[model samples]
Structure formats: structure tokens, C-alpha cells
Target chain A: MKNRLRLLAYPYILWMALFVVAPIVIVVIYAFGSAGGGFTFDNFSRMGTYLPVFIRSFKLAFEATVFCILLGYPLAYILSKESSRSQGILVLLVLLPMWMNFLLRTYAWMSLLENTGLINKLLTLIGLSPVKMINTPGAIILGMVYNYLPFMVLPIYSVISKLDYSLIEAAQDLGASSAGVFRRVIFPLSLPGVLSGITMVFVPSVSTFVISQLLGGGKYMLLGDLIELEFLGSAYNPYLGSAVALVMMIVVIIMLLIMNRFGEGEEQAVMI
Target chain B: MRDKKSRVPGRIFLALIYIFLYAPIIVLLIFSFNSTNSRTVWSGFSLRWYEKLFNDDMVINALYTTISVSILAAIIATVFGTFAAIGIFNLRRRWQSPVLTLNNIPLMNADIVTGVSLCLLFVASGTILGFGLGFITLLLAHISFNVPYVILSVMPKLKQLDNNLVDAAQDLGCTWLQAFFKVVVPEIKPGIVNGALIAFTMSIDDFIISYFTAGSGTQTLSMVIFSMTRKRVTPEINAVSSLMFVFVLILLIIINIRSSVQDKKLRAKPA
Candidate 1:
């Protein structure tokens, strides 16, 4: 039986090994090699060239994450507080657009933010100056929020929905004010969801290409765009792109590990 | 707290969010019928864009390509993923979590990084072997990206299965494969269906991976939309998007309805 099970496990394990494990291993190996020569530390040595790109990507990702948290938390709280029937409707509303294509949705943002689009027209009608919302950092941030807000809300909603209401009442009955009740009772309980949501939003937004390409325009040089330009553009340098990709993987792995540890700790705390 | 004033802001926020999400869709639908090439102005509604969309041979080719790729990828990924999930269930406890995590890593990795890395790998392979990129590259990329999602979706159902049925089937002299086919599959068939649905959607909706992997003639629907929007916003693109949205909405509703009906029948079965 055990031998049969082991045989059954072969195809799955091999599939993952070839696709997930092999591609990343290839990246790490290329990251250590010189572009056109023997093995060297040249890739790592030139890290200074890419440090600003990392910083900019990290900053934009951080800002987008913060926006997701702020917008997603209240929406989650409201959904959690509602009756399950209405909550179902709310969840559907959030997920419907999510099921559509990501590129399509980003294109939708382009239409909405265009100078002659609806928002600008509305602004003109109200006698306000037309603001160039498209192709700005603000547009990138808005696009991030629009794409990822559902991801943030769902996890937090799962956490908040399962929260014990009696805990809030207990705090209130002990003369805790509204803010105190929230801080002491609600926030701590929902930290797992918050952490997971932030990780989800941050990791993807950090390396998203289509959004930055369509909405951010070529004006901005995100890490994703840089990697694309090197790997796929006129510069056809796979070695450099591989190095950048490896660095991104390492950073994201670190973040995910941190989030996992935090989540585990929070779970233990909740159990206690 | 349940009173009117407390609910007011929440109601407004919900409304605003709905508007934010759906307004683009509404505009896309409206503009699809506008006679003007520029989508913003009101030049009277007509079916001209729809007519043009049908006549465009490139659009038709892209639609065919996108549908074929998604369907093929969905089937292969679902089969591989389901087998993998079952195999993982039978694995030693110590190795299971890590293996699962390894599989999930693909799901979490950024699309751009994955696309670039895969493109490089294919380029290297093609250079070494003297082959050109085409449908095979596209399929492999789709399968790699989709298998993880399928595993994640179906694993939970596999975990919930009762072990006794398989044991009983084995005791009745059924072969292992027979037992698995007769006992295990039917129990978790819903998971397989759900996993396949998700894979289909993800494969169809993917932009970055397809962009990287597709050849000049193998453009998908999303690639067409991307190129069109870059050139200029046209009512034809809007017509396509609105149609795509409605198609997805209908699919979602049908899936939900089918599952609910199945649930009802399951509940009526003998305990």
C-alpha cells in the first residue's frame, strides 16, 4: 500500500519539481553568474544599480498595501456586521469584477481616468480643472486598491465574521469605551487576516506589470517593467532579468515567511 | 448601533464601492453601441461596433485562440492537479505541508517574475534545441501557473473524504485503481469540477504569462484588448469587454445554481 501511494505521488511531485522548483533554481543559478563570462559575483556586485528600483517598488507596494487595509477594513467590518444574507450579496458584488480579466479591469480604469472620460467630464461640468489622474502614482495606487481590495476584504471578513461578539460586549460592560473596545477586543483578533491580506496585496503589487504598464504608463520604471525591458525588450539580457527575478523572489519569500510566523503566533494566541 | 444614522455611512460606502466597480462596466456597455469612434462623446447609439467586431477576422482568431487554450489548459491542469492532490493526501505527514507549500509558491509568485523567468527558460531551451516558441510553450506556461490553484481548490475536499469506503472496496477484491475510481472520485468530484472551473477562468483571464509565451500569430483576447487600448480607446473594445463580462456573470450564476441543486439533492439522500 505504501509503495503504491509512493508511486501515485510521483507525477505530482515531478510536476512541481520541474515547474516551480526548477524555474526558481535556474533563476538563482543565473543570478550568481556574469552576463557573458564565467561564474562570478558580478550580478550581486551590481546590486547598487538596482537598489533604487527595489526602493521605489517597495514604496509603491507599501502605499498600495496601506490603501487596501484602510479601504478593505471598514468594508469588511460592515459586511461582517450584516446579516449573512446581505453579506452574501456584498461578497458577490466584490467577487464579480474580480472574476473578470485583470487586463480588462485595468483597461476599464484607463477609460475612467482618461482626460476626456467620465470623471474628467464630471469635473468639467462642476467647473473644476481637469486633473491628470491617469498615468500617475495615484493612478497606480488606485488601480492596486481596485484590483486587490477584494483579496483584503475576504480574509479580514473571514476573521471578523468568526470573532466572538460576546468579547466586545464584555469589554463594554466593563466600562470600556467604543475605541477601547475596538482596540482591545476587535483589532487583535483580526490581525491574522490583516497580515495575510497585506502580504497578498503587497507581494503582487510589487511585481505587477500590466497595471504599471497600462495605468502607470512608461513614465514610471517599476521593478516589473525594468525586468521586462531587460528580458523581453531590445536589451534581451536574460542574465540580468534572472538576477532581478531572483532578488524579487528572495524579498517576497522573506515577507511571506514573516507573515506566516505572525499568523501562526496569532493562531496560538487565539487558541489560548 | 443598528439604527439609521449608524447605517447611513456604511450604505453610502457600499453604494460608492459598487459604483466604482460597476461604472466602468456600465460605460463599456453604453459605449459599445455608440456610433462614434471616440467612446466619450454621444454620437447616437447603434449596433455598428458590434457589427464591426464580428467582421474583424483578427478578433475572431484571437477569440478562438483564447478559448482553445483555456479549455485545453483547464483539462490537463485539472487532471494533473487532482491526481497530485490525492497523492499528497497519501503522503507521510511530515512531508505533506512542505510539498503543499511548494506547490502554492507558484500561486503567490508575481506574474511578471514568472512570465520573465519562463520566457528566459524557453528562450534558453529553444536556443539549445533549435526549436521555435508556439502553442506548446503557451500550454506549458498555462499548466505551470494553473496547477497550483487547482491543487489548492481540490485538496480540502480530498481531506474531508472518509477512508473506510476505500478500505471496504479493497477488501471486496477491487484493484487499487478500481477502488479509487469507484469510491474516491465520486466523493470528491465536486472539488474536481470546482478546480477545473477556477483553472479555466485563470487561464482565460491571464495576461502577463500569455503575453510572454504567445507567438506573433497566437494572440489571445486580452492581448488584442491591450493593443487596442494602447492605440486608442474605441467602442469596439468596449463592446468586447461588456460581452465578456456578461458571459462570466452568466457562468458564475449557472455554477452557483447547479451546486445549490446538488446540495438540495444531497440533503434529501438517506442518512
Candidate 2:
């Protein structure tokens, strides 16, 4: 029975090796190997030219992550304080938009942000000047925050809801001010969720092509857009695409390591 | 009085956030019922887009592909992941962490990276052994990405399970297969179901990976919607989005009700 049970994992192991491990290995080889199949370092060196794109990607992703934290934390805190039934319903409400196709959601934003769109129409009706919202970096950041805010909220909400209210009460009883109690007790306790949320938002935001493509109107080029262009656009080069992907993977892995450190080996709870 | 004042601000803040989160979806839903195709103008209420959606072969094909691929990927990943979790749970402590870390790589890695890497692999292999990229490669990519989520979801349940029950069942003259089928499977059924649900959602929501892996001829709903948006925004796509939103919303409501009932029953039991 033990042997049979052990044998059950063989298929999974084989599949992982062939599909997961081998593809990554291929990516590495393509990143380092020349088009003629000889080893070369040109791909890595060529990445230097696209330094601006990389910086912009990280900057936009960082800004988006900050916005998500600011907006999501309060909502998550309030939801955590709700009755369990309302908590369930409110969390579902937050997550329901995510169930709709992300492209559609972004498209909806595109329409609203356009010059003659609904928002501008509303602004005109109210005697306010219409602001240029589309085809800008701010628009891309808005799309990122809109699409990935749920990722930030769910983890933080899970952590905050699981927190023991007694700790806050204890801190207050010890003559701590309300702000001090939150700073010393609640904020410190929720760091793991915050870290996870940051990674959850930043990683996808940095690596997204679709959001920038739809919202940025092709005027703004992020790292994702650059890598995608290399593979599928006019300057189609798989080797360079692999190199860019390799670099993005390294950055994401570093973020994951930081997340794991803050998570302290119990990261599964934040999956909600 | 102060508590009430503070609570009002928090409630208002939450309301504003909900509005922010839902504004796009509400806009999409309204447009889905609009008579005119223009997004800015309301030409009266009509279900013309929904009617057009049903008649569109391309949209129907993409929908079919998306649903089938997600279901297939979810089932296959769940089976493999359940067994893998069991096997890893039974392994020596030293080996378990390394195996789990490997499992987390795909989950932690960016989708664009995974998609590109898989695309390279398929292209590389095609040159060497004539393997091609299309629906099969897309399905494989989905399954590979989904397995880790299933493993993560199931491993915790496996840990909480009592080993003694399985041992007792085996002692009652049950074979290994019988014990596993009757005892272990039932014990971890919730985790298995949860894992499948997560896998299904992940597979269905996936776009970047499917975009790269799906060669020119194949398209998932996401890929179709993406291309449609790139060319021109169509009301038919809005109709499809509305249907998908309602479908998932209904599914989630059912799941929530069932779980709350289970929670009530568990609470009613004596400790």
C-alpha cells in the first residue's frame, strides 16, 4: 500500500520535470545562447539599452502598490470590523469585479477616462473642466490599482480579521493612545499581510502588458510591453524576450523572498 | 457620540472604496444593455448585444474553449496535486521543504515570464522534435500553473487530517486502495473541492499565458476580448462580460450559502 501510494506521485513528478522545470531551462538557454546555438552574453548586454523602460515599469508598479495599500487598508480594516455575514458579503462584492474578465474591466475604464467619455460628460454637466486622463502614465497606474486592489485587500483583510481584538484592548489598558495602540499592536501584527500584498500588487503590476496596452494607448512602454514587443511585435526576437523575462523573474523572485521572510513560513493564510 | 462620528467616517470611506471597485463593472453592465454601440451615449435600453453575442460563432467558440480548458485543467491539476500533497506529506522533513519550494516557483513567477518561457520551450522543441504549439500547449501551461495552487490548498488539509483513522481502516482488513478511497479521500474532500475551485478560477482568469501559448488559430475568451479591444470595442464583448460576471456571482453565492450552513451545523454541535 505504501509503495502504491508513493507511486501515485510519479506522474506528477514527471509532469513537473517536463513542463515546469524544462521550460524554464529552455528560457535560460535561450537567454544565454546565440541564435546559431552557441553560448553568448549579448542578450544580457543588450538589456542595458532598455534601462529606461525597466525603471519606468518599477516606478509605475511602486506607485500603484502604494495607492493600493492606502486605499485597500482602510477598506480591509472596516470589512474586518463588520459582522461575519456582512464581512462575507462585502468581501464578495470586492471580489466580484475580479470574476469579470480583466480586459473588460480595463476597457470600461478606457471608455470612462476618454476625453468625451462619461466622466468628462459628468464634469461638463457640473461646470468643471475635463481633465486629460487617458493615454498617460497616471491612466496605466489607475488601471493597475483597479485591477490588482483586490489582491492587496484580501490578504490584509484575512490577517486583520484573524487578529485578536484583546491585544488592542490590552494595549489601550496599558495607557497607550489610540494611534499608539494601532502603531504598536495592529500595524506590527499586520506586516506580514502588508508585505504579501505589496508583492501581490507590485509583481503583477510590473509585469503586466495588457493593462498598459489598453490604458496607456501604446504611448507608454513598460518592461512588460518591451518584452512582449520583442516576441510578438515588429522587432520579434525570442532570445531577447527570454532575457527580459529572465530579468523579470529574478526581480519577482527577490520580492517573493522578501514576502516569505515577512510571512515567517505561514504564507498560505493570505491566499484568501 | 465620538464613536458614532468615527464610525460614520469609516462607513463613508468603505462606501467610497466600494464605489471605486465597482464603477467599471457597473459601467460595463449598463453598456451591455444599451441600444447603441457607442460607449458615451445611452440610446435607450435594449438587449441587442446579448442577441448578437449568441449569433457570433467566434465568441461562442472562444467561450467553449475557455470553459473546456479550465475544467480539464482544474480536474487534472487537482488529481495530481492531491496525490503530490499526500506523497510530500509522507516524505522526510528535509525533502518536503525543497519540494514545496519548487512548487511555489510557478506561483511566484510572473505570468508573462511563464508564458514566454513555455512559448520558447514549445518553439525550441518544435525545431528538435516537430512538437507544435496550440490548444494542447495552452492546456499544458494551464495545468502546470494550476497544480501549485491545488497543492497549496490541499496540503493544509492533509496536515490537519488524523493519521490514526487511516491506520485503523487498514487494520480492519481494508486494502491500501480501499482505505485511501473510503477514508483519506472523504477526510480531505473539502480541501480537494477548494483546490479544484481555485484551479478553475485561475485557469479561467488566465490570459497572458494562454495568449503566448495559444498559436494563431486558437483563442480563449480572454484572448478574444483582448483582440477585440485592440481592434475596436464591441457591445457583444460587453454582453459576454455581463454573462460571465453573473455566472460567477451566482456560483459564489451558492458556495457561500452552503458554507454558512455548514458553519451553523458545526456550531450547533456539542463541544
TM-score of each: 0.94, 0.95
**What shift in Å separates residue A133 of candidate 2 from its native position after superposition?**
0.5
Please, what are the lDDT tens digits per residue for candidate 1 over residues B1-271? Answer: 5677888899898888889888877787788888888667878979988899999998999999889999999999999988888788788889888998898777778887777667767766788998666788888999998888888888899889888889999999999889989999999998899889989999989988888877665789988988887786678888888889889989988988998898899899965
The residue ranges of model 2 lying beyond 4 angstroms of the native Cα positions read A1-4, A255-272, B264-271
Candidate 1 lDDT, A1-272, residue by residue in tens: 65566566678888778777777777777777766767877776776788988888888889999989998999898888788878887888888998777877888788779888778999999999888988898888888888988889999999999988899889899999988988777988898899889878987899877788788886777888878877767867677778887888798889788878978897688668
Q: Which parts of model 1 have CA positions greater than 4 angstroms off? A: A164-178, A259-272, B172-175
lDDT of each: 0.84, 0.87
Please give, for residues A1-272, the per-residue lDDT of candidate 2 as tens digits.
45456566667777778888998998898889776889999999999998998889999999999999999898888898877868888888888888877888898898899999889999999999999999999999999999999999999999999999898889889999988987778877887888889888998999999989999998889888988898878888888888988897787677668667757654444333
Q: Least lDDT summed over 10 consecutive residues: which range in candidate 2 chain A?
A: A263-272
RMSD of 2: 3.2
Q: What is the TM-score of chain B alone in each candidate?
A: 0.95, 0.96
Q: Each model's DockQ?
A: 0.67, 0.68
CA RMSD per model (angstroms):
2.2, 3.2
Error of 1 at B4 (Å): 4.3
